[model samples]
Target: MAETKGLGYELIWKFDMPTTINHIMIMEDIQYGELIRKYKVEGKVNGEWRILTEGESVEHKRIQKFDKVEVRGIR
Candidate 1:
């Protein structure tokens, strides 16, 4: 688990090669208003970055699934 105390922080993951991604899960500590309330998930596809999912006022545990997409990185 990772945590940031301020706003505008980002977490990213990079893969060695293109891979299919079908699901994403985010876990957060229960910190009320201090928790992550909004976030966006993006993936690199065909040399371009695209948004796969986005949320506002999110909860402690969030999960998202979509049609498998080829990607080399996510943030």
Candidate 2:
């Protein structure tokens, strides 16, 4: 994916059934320099969107671990 240049972007994944999420990983193509300076990982919990983790920056990769949550979708 390409940078949005301040417009920002969002990507989502949906499962056929609720799946327990323990952690997430995000990566940037460092060959072009890290463009992602901030990001958030959220999960759909109990029909509501809840922030699972957030960060200030991500270079080549970032991994976030959190208490397992069951959800049907994530973004």
Writing each residue's lDDT as its tens digit, candidate 2 over 1-75 gives: 121223238887767778898999998888977789888888888888899999978888899999999987788
lDDT of 1 by residue, 1-75 (tens): 132233357876777889898989988777644478788989989988999998875577778988899998888
TM-score, candidate 2, is 0.86
Highest TM-score against the true fold, candidate: 2
Off by over 4 Å in 1: 1-8, 31-34
**Runs in model 2 lying further than 4 Å from the true structure:** 1-8
The 0-to-1 C-alpha lDDT of every candidate, in the order given, reads 0.79, 0.82
Cα deviation of 71, candidate 1, in Å = 0.4
Any idea what lDDT model 2 has? 0.82
